[model samples]
Every structure is written in C-alpha cells, then in structure tokens.
Target chain A: MGLMETFFNLDVLHSSALALLEGLKLTITLGLTSLVTSFAAGLILVLGRLYGPMPIRVIAIAFIDIFRAIPLLVLLVLVYYALPFVGINFSPFWAAVTALSLVASAYAAECFRAGIEAVAIGQFEAAKALGFSWTDMMKDVVLPQALRLVIPPSTGIGISLIKDTALASVVAMPDLLKQALQAQAFYANPSPLIGAALLYLIILLPLVRIVSSIEERQKRAAGR
Target chain B: MTHQKATQPFIKITDLQKFYGQFQALHDINLAVEKGQILALIGPSGSGKSTLVRCINLLEQFQAGTIEVDGIEVKEGRNLNKVRAEVGMVFQQFNLFPHMTALKNVAIAPVRVRGISWEEAEKKALALLERVGLSQHAHKRPSQLSGGQQQRVAIARALAMEPEVLLFDEPTSALDPEMVGEVLDVIQKVAETGVTMLIVTHEMSFARRVSNRVIFMEQGRIIEDTPPEEFFGCGPKTDRAQLFIRSVLQGHPDAGLTAPLQVLED
Candidate 1:
C-alpha cells in the first residue's frame, strides 16, 4: 500500500514479463508489416493522384477519402466481423493489418503529395528540358527531393501508425495492448499496462528524437 | 567570323501566333536564324520576346504557325526529346538542380539521355565547368554557389549536351548588376565557339558586342530585324524602335545623358 508497492511492484512485474515480451513481438511484426505495406500503397496512391490518367486519379482520390474518413477501430471491426458475412473472413491479425495499412496509406499519400508539390516547378521543367522522360524525371529528380522534404512528416506518420497498432487489440489480435490487459486481469495488477507503456516509450523514443533532429536540419537547410 | 549562307536557315519560324486565354501573346511572328549566328532579341517587358524564344524550343506551344530547328519542325505528337537535346535552353532563373552538385548538374543529361558512361559524362562535364570557370565549384550544390556562378553552371550544363543551338531567355536578367558581367563574359566565350544562339537580353551594350543580328519587338510584333550596328547605331528603323533605343540609352547612367539627346536630335 506504499507508492513503490503499488506502482512498481517487482513481483507483479516479474510475473507479467513473459506475456509482455510475447506481446512486444506481435507489436513489432505488425508494425513492420503494416509500415512496409502502407508505405508502398501510399506511394502508389501518390503517383496515381499526381500523374495518373483521369480514371486512376479519380479512383485514388475516392480510396483516400473513404479510408481517411473512417476511424481505424471501426475499420478493424468491419474488416474482421462484418466481412465474415460476405464470405471474405480474415484472421484477427490480418484484419488489423488491413485496416491499419489502409488508413495509414491514405494519410501517407497526402503527406507524400504535399512533399512532391513543395518541390519548385522549375525542377520539373529543368528535368524535362534536360530530356528526361516522365518516368526518369519522377524517379531521378522529383521523388528523391520530395522524399527528403517529407522525412519529418513521414516519420511522424510512422510513429502514429506504431501507436495505432495498439488499436488492433479491439479485434482480439493478442497484440501488446490485448496481452497487457489480459495480464492485468490475471494478476489483478496494473503493472503490465505500465510495462507495455514503458516498452512503447523505449521503442519510440529514439525514433521521436530522430524525427526532431531531422526537422531541425531541414529547417536550417531551408534557411540556407 | 564566317556566316552561314543566307539560304540555309537553321531556325525558321513562320506566322507564329500564341495566345494566353483571350489575350494575344504573340502575333504573326516570322523569323529565321542562320547557323552560328548570335541573334539578340531586345524588347520592352510584355513584348513577347520571352514568349517567342520559348516557342523556339516548344516550351510554350504556339497557337498557330511552325517552328523549325535545323529543319525539324516543332509541333504536337513529335518526340521532342531528340530535338530538345539538340537545342539547349538556359532560363533567366538559372534553374540548377538544387539537389545535385555542379558537376552532376552538367553530367546528368549526358548520362541519362545520351546513355554515356558516368566517367565519360563527368569528364565532359568537368571540362564544361572549367570552361565556365567553375571547375573549383564542381562539388558544390547550386544553393552554395553565387547567383552568377549558378548561372555559369547552368550555361555549362546546357553546353555539356553539345547542342547545335543554345537559347538564352534573359540569361543575365536575373543576375546582380555586378555579377551580370561575369555571366556575360562566359556567354561571350560561348559565342566564340561558333554555336548558334538566340539571346533575349536587356544588356544593349552586351548584345551589341556579341550579336551578329538584333531583333526589336513591340506589342507582340517584330518592328526591326537588322544588323546590330544599324539597330544600335545611326538609326532604329521605326519610331517605336527609335523610342525604345532612346529610352534604353537614357536609362543607362553610363550613356552620359547625351546619347538619348542624339537619338532625339535624329
């Protein structure tokens, strides 16, 4: 009933350590898979929005609008539960990933589009004048510069997606949050949730620092 | 300097017309640029000098008429890459690729378009940079270089393609007054290489010194197309050309205030 006994109970912490570790593994796997898939999907959407013919552009726009408008939890529930009635049932993990990646791609596409637009018109004109085809121009000139420009924001999206992975617990994925809640119920202690929170901080703190430093460098570069 | 025969036109434009929405930007423009000729286009702002030069490279498509560079007509549906590679354009803004080094800026086109080896492209690019007196700044990015140096690097980039003709759309117009001389000096050196060039410039003296021919445009029309000496000297043919010459001379403090008086006297 002391502060240390209540908040930092080593006995409870030790008991929940194994469950927390398993949850961490799921969190990492989900994060990495979702991140890669979302980034790829986002780039495609960005390209479609920027350079596609009319039909593709309209499709990209519609997809982005719908995914971004829905909450990730609602998306997860719909994918995991509602899709079973449509004969397209998915596992909890896959449902979580699909929802997360879809929403993340929508946001990431907007970030990437902004980055591309931030590049001056002259760069495109210069690339064209230098006899670069559209593909070469985008690959060699525009994308490199634009990706550099959007690093800070893209990292922000990454951190956000990382946190949003916790929402996968709603679909019974046995991810970090779900495992932590289960451990808390079994031990009748809150320490597992705190441990999970600490684990998240440990993983994300370096990334947060990296993003800030990158932003600082970008600011100084802009000033120059 | 030997001039190409009058019969051989390297660049020929006939009945060129351009419009932006309802406003006419160029009207009934006809011009011919012989090979190796340094032609200076001088005109007041809003006079279509830039538009006409841009049309030569098909940067701005004309509403009507044809532009032929080395007898390759510029029009819709043509593969412009080949023709564009043959004609290098330097913008007034010195649009250097900010991400690349000076050497890379000059080397990229050859490597990307000409399918040359990187080493060969860099070798040619370095020689061009040296020609422009920017060899020391080869590793520097465009942002690190001064405006004049960036423009010089742009000229080197344009030259690295070994284009048959170079287009200058107000090359010196974006430079600081002091830096203008350095860019013009490099341009003067480029002129001596016998490459045909069309320069839209406001530097009347520099144009007089470098141009074989001078074109005067007004209200989207060419008012005078004559030798530089005649265009800059004893008389400008039309009253508008005369007024322009007087105004240009009068604006230059170096003109000693008597030059405009002489034109007025005439």
Candidate 2:
C-alpha cells in the first residue's frame, strides 16, 4: 500500500482508463455540438448588437448581461431539474448541452461584438462606398476580420467548454469525470483519479498549444 | 475644355444641406462635374467636402438636397441602389472586407448587389485588381497587404461595380507617406480611363495634379471653386484660395473648418 506501488497499480489504472475512454466520446460530442450552437448564436447576437433595431439591440444586450452574470452550475441545475416540472423534460445529456451552450453563447456574443466594433469605422464606410449592402458588409469584410480578431478568445472558450463538460457528470450524462468517479468507487482505490487527470490533460494539452500559438500569431499580426 | 458632348455633365449637386442633431455639417452646397472630369474637393477636414461626395450616393442622408448622377435624381428615402451601382466610391481606410481575399472583396458587390454571377463577378474582379496593380495580391486578405495595396484593392472593388462616376474620400489620407504615392497612382490611372471622379483630399499636390477643377470648402460653404491651375500657386479671384494654398504648403491646416486649430496647433 505504499504510495509508489499504489501509483502504478495496474488493476485500478486499467478500470479507470477504460471508463475514461468510454466517457471521452460523450464529452467530445457535447463539446462540439454545444460549441457550434454557441458560435452561431453568439454571431447572431453580435450582429444584433451592431445593426438591429432598438428593441432587438436591447434584447441582445440584456440576454448577454443576464446569462453572463449567472453561474454555470446554477444554470445546469435549473435546466436539468427545474425545467421538468415546467414540462420541458430533456435527457441529462441534452440538459447539459443546453445549459452550457446558453452560457457560452452569452460570453461568445460579447467577444464577437467587441471584435466587430474593433474594425475601424472606415471599413464600414469603404464597404458602402464600394456599393456593398449591409449584409454584404458582414459577409465580405467586417465579420471576416472581426472573426480573426476574435479567434484566439473563441478558441480559449473551447477549452472552457471542454472543461465545462465535466459538470455534465453531475447531471448523470456519463462524461469522463463521472466515469472516473464510478471506477474509483468500484475499485476502492484513488489511482483511478490519476487516469482521469491524464484524460483531462490529454484532451486539453493540444488545445492549449493551439490556443497559444494562434493567439501568438494574432498578436504578431496586430503588432504589424 | 473638350467636355464630352455625349458624356455630358454626369454629376450635379444642388442645394445639399446636412445637419447633425442641431449642428450643421454641410450647408447649401452646390457643384457639377462633366463626364471624364476629375473634380477635387479641397478644404479643412470638417469643411463638408467628404460629406458632399458621400451624399452623392446617399452614404450620408442630407437633410435637404437633390443630387442627379447621369440622369438619375437622388433625394431622401429614394431608391439609391441604382445610383450606388452607377457611382463608385473609395474611402481613406480602404475598407476591403477583411474576411475576403482581394478578389472576393472585389467580387462581392457585383455578385450580391449587382446580381452578377459569381464566376463572372470574380473574373471582372481579377481584371480590375490587375488594372489597379494588385493582381498578385488578389488572393491575399486585406490585413496581409500594405495600406497602399489595400486601397488599390478598394479601388478595384469599386470599379468592379462599373459605376459611371468614382468618389474618393481622402483616398490617400489614411496611407503612410511612402504608401500614398502608390494609391494616388492607382487613382491617376483610373482617371486616365476617362471615368468621372469626385475626390476629397488634403494632398494638395495630388489635388492639383489629378483634378480638372479643385473646389475649396470652408464651414460647410464653397469658399472658392477654380481649375487646378488657378486653385494653387497664385490667384486674383481668390483671397481665400491663396490663403488656403499658403497655409497648406506651410503644413498649418489651421483654417478650422472641422476641428478648432488649437488642439492640432499646440
């Protein structure tokens, strides 16, 4: 029962490793689906802030502020537990995705809005002078540049989204952390915790590299 | 002046007035440009020179005025689509869409605004980009290129719309000194093709070199309007024009038409 032998215990490690692998798929699925939804929703919200009529702009601002203020854990508990009584039952898998995406979208929207506005006012005028309509301005010029400006932040958001998937385990979605917990319970050893940590690291490390490299390039470009 | 008979006075501005909340930005401005003529709008920044050109395409909706481009009468809330299609405008910032390659940036209005097929629009975009001396940079995004190259791309984007008149809003003002020459060169080439142009610029030498007529505006009014030759160097008809020339030459743009001189002066 020495720390060294416990660390290398093949049986405990094997159980958790298998469970981690099984949970990895759901984690990825949740991350990707919610990421896409958040991106789309965020983009629209940014556009609303920029060009929408008064009511629309107000709604967008309010949505972004309110959700951003709320804790993600509270949002999750509500979507998973409270909504069912109101007749909005969803599987724990979907509940986690919905809650995460809503919060993510709020933050993403703010990021995009700031990015879009970061483009010089002259860019918009140039588009108009060049005979582009409002929508064409976004499709051709504004969003493209703004998206580049926002890319590093958005990728950083992805890491948070992936980590956030761990919260899904609380709702019984069988994501990696939850499986790790179950394996620990079954094997009666904490060695499985190491496997879980390894899985989180494996998923997050490359992303960290990508985020930093891209962010570095963005900075270089900005300096130019 | 060998003013083109068929080419006609392609642009006419009548009684254009603009107010920004109670402050007047442009007041009772009037101007005219014959076909193939290069008209330079020269003045201090807030002199309403840029505002006038922007109004021709309704980029800024004037409180009261009428603008006729070619044969089309432009007024408030009227259909500007056709007028914008026929008139090309370039801006100082060279707002080529950052998301697009120079080629895609050029092709967008033609494809979307003008309803041209994407392939056809792209072909025209490439040719025009070449004309502006940016053929090599057609596939690069705006950020990847220098300011001069981006402005040329902006020019190419405007030309792709095939407008009868091109507008330049201090096209070289935002450029670095080294980059100004290249963008002005592109503009000069466009002028050579006999397309009509209206430009607002502070590059006094450029205004003289490229303009057939240079108009000086001050405090939302046309202080003086004269041919390039008379607009610079020396003059009898313009006490205002002579004074503007000497100040601009000495790099003292103090003729506060937009912002007061103190902030820039001391």
Candidate 3:
C-alpha cells in the first residue's frame, strides 16, 4: 500500500472515528480536570511557600521539590500500581489525574512564585500603607498583577498538561492514544493515530497562539 | 471629636532608634508635631530623613522607640492597620496600582479597607481627583498618565482615605523638572486642608514656602529644627547645616536662592 493508504487511510479513519471520538472525550475530561486541580493546588502551594508559617512553608517546599524532581510516568505508574499495595486505591482515571496534577502543580507553583516575586516591593508597601490586610492585599492587588504577569507561562504549563494527558493511556484510561493504539491493532492501519495527533493539534495550537499573542500584548503594555 | 488638650501633640516620637542590620538609620529622635502643622525634613542623602518620615506611619520598624499617632502607640503585633488608616503616605515612586485606573486607585482603599460602598468611594475619589486637577484623567491608567498626573492621582488616592496626617516622602523627587510643579501644587493645596504633614524634600524653596517648620538631619540625628524663615533666612544654625545649604545652593541654581554668593559668604 502507498503511504497515504497505509498511514492515512480514509476508510480506516472513517471506521475508527467513533472510537477516537470516545477517546477524545476522555482525554479532554482528564486534561481539563487535571488542569484545574493543578492550578488551584499550585496557587495554594505558592501561597504557603511564600507566606505560610514555617511548617506549612517547609511542607510546600518539599512537595514542590519532590514532585518536580520525579518523572511523571514513574509517578503515574506508582500511583496506579504501587498505591494499591498499601491499600490506597484509585481508579485508572483518578490515578492519571493525581499524577499529572502533582507534577503540573509543582511547575505551576514555580511559575506563580516567579510572577509574584516580579511584583515591585513598592507595591507591597503601597498596599500596606493603604490599610489593606495581608489577605486583601494579596487578593486585590498582588495576585491580580501577578496573574497578568503569569498568563503566558501558566498557559504554557496548561498546554504541556494537555499534551501529557496521552500518558493516561498507560493506566488503561482509554484516552485518545489508547484508542488509537487499539484501532491500529484492530484494523492494521496507523490512520487513527494520525487522526488522534490531528485532534491534539486542533486543541493545542490555538492555545499556543493565544500565549504568544498575550506575550506580545504584555510587551507592548510594558513598552508603553 | 474626643475632648483632648489643645497642647497635646497629634503625633509624637520619643527616643526613636532605627537600624538596618548593624548600621543605625535613626538615632535618639524626639519629635512632637502639632495638629495642622506642616513640617519639612531636609538633609543630604543618607541623613535618615526618609527613614524618620517612614517610621511615623510605622512603614519602617524602629529597634527602640515609641511612635504615637492620634493617641495610639505603634509597636510590634498591634493592629497597625487602624493607625495606617489614619495616616496616609505618598511615596517618591507614586506606586499607583498599574492595573487600576486613577479613579479605581483612589477608591480601592476606601471600599476595601474603610468599608465604604463602591459608589460612595468612587464619588469621593472623583472629588479628590478634581481637587488634584485630574478629574478628567480619572479613567486613565498610571502608565497612560504623565509622571505629574500619576503623582497627582497618588495624592488623590491618599486623600481619599481621609487621614488626619499625610506623609510625603520626597514625593516629587522622581518627577521631571516640569512635572514637579503640578504635584507640589496639589500637595500645597492638601496642606491648606489642615492635615498635619511631614514632607521629606530636597526642594529648598518649596519647603521654605510651604512648611511652617524645617528640620535638618545629618548622620541619623536632627541637626537643626527651626521655623523655615529662621532656617532659610539666617541660614542653618550649625556649621554642617551652613556648609550643606551652601553646597545645595551651588548645585541647584534654580533653588530660589537669590544670591548664592551671599549665602556662601554666610
């Protein structure tokens, strides 16, 4: 068979489309769930590391360091396969989410820390002089500015998280990559895998473009 | 108003000592500022003038001293927000919230900290912007405004809190020469409202014109404290102050010193 017929077979793609669609749904669900959990957890981790009491700060630092150092695939396997030995069981879906969130949260925390530290010291003093409580200052002044500063990097993390959802296939969550592999075995064609790659590109390319545009806009704002 | 003696100082500091690591920033400072008095603090760089003003509002912690603002003593672990609410500070950098417009910058503290409604806060903020002659520019962000306008907005933001005392820490030192006049003009108007003020400034002429009293500091101590007329007229009482004033006059030809040679001879 020619390359197009073997690798990009329209007949195979049409036949396997439904299965790929099912996988796409699960992939999106896992990616979005992990993205949200990681972002929220990242914010908490950063706040604790920066402002919490000594014990909390130490725990936050340790968590970030450990998760960031460990390979995500190893952590995923351990969470799925090893945790049951200790009687802590999670479903394949949850295991993937837990592993992804742990690692992504660490990266997100570092991104947030960088954004927060970039804020001028004068901003803190200004908020304090205005009688804002520490919480109010963080919520109303510091975080808002930091959020603006962090969008590009944080979205970069989100894109990576979305791409990393493919790793969920190893846990038998039947995400896009898993579905494509199954389709390839059933029909003896690589078309479904190409289709899955196309779907990922469709979702992530716009996000990549958005990050660059935001960065450009921020640069222009700074220049002004 | 609570019944208090007319002789009581509105803000008082006694034996205040501040340190940055092992280096002393302020030494044995004692000052009592009456209500409605505008005092200008002037000194050479590193003379602790900014440090002294900053301590009044508890922005800088002193190693040993007492600071009393409106009868409340400032110290560690106290609810300093209440004291800060009563004392407004305008920084040399302006420090306006870059993300907020001028009106929002003026209104945020009142709405968030003072518990005023947003409508009321915005109304007061607009009025303050008008007072600062920036009412039309209220919708503009700090970056969109010139240095003078940003500083005016900052002054308005501080005034919106309705503090009894205002601290200006070299408020115009960061502005261009042309922009300085507009900001100082707003501050001069703020002074007319009878809020007690302490200004750290290098503008000798403005201090002489705007302040009832002038303080000179050298090496973490107040070298001279006298009425502006006495301090600027007969020159400073101390030899160091005399030499400092002479050098300042020669450095800035536009300090409103009519005769540099005459002051140098003194």
Question: Candidate order by lDDT, highest to lowest?
Answer: 3, 1, 2
Winner by TM-score between candidate 3 and candidate 2 = 3
Could you tell which candidate, 2 or 3, scores higher by lDDT? 3
- Report the C-alpha lDDT of model 2 over B188-262, residue by residue, as the tens digit: 888889998989987776777888987888888998878877656455266766666556656664853321222
Off by over 4 Å in 2: A5-8, B1-10, B68-78, B98-101, B133-150, B175-186, B203-209, B228-236, B249-266
* CA RMSD per model (angstroms): 3.6, 5.0, 2.7
DockQ of 3: 0.86
- Best candidate according to DockQ: 3
Residue range with the least summed lDDT across 10 consecutive positions in model 3 chain B = B256-265
Q: Which lDDT tens digits does candidate 2 get at residues A157-209?
A: 88898899999988998988888788888888777767878878998999999
- Chain B TM-score for all candidates, comma-separated: 0.92, 0.89, 0.93
Q: Estimated TM-score per prediction?
A: 0.93, 0.87, 0.95
lDDT of 1 by residue, A39-115 (tens): 99999999999899999999999999999999888999999999999899889889988999999999999999999
TM-score of chain A of each: 0.97, 0.96, 0.98
Residues B1-266 of candidate 3: C-alpha lDDT, one tens digit per residue: 23346777989899999999999999999999999999999888889999998897777988998998877787645568888888899999999999999999999999998899999999999999999998999899998999999999999999989998999999988888889889988999889988899999888888888999999998899999999889888778899888788778787443322333333233
Candidate order (DockQ): 3, 1, 2
Model 1 interface DockQ:
0.66
Candidate 3, superposed: residue stretches over 4 Å from native: B1-7, B252-266
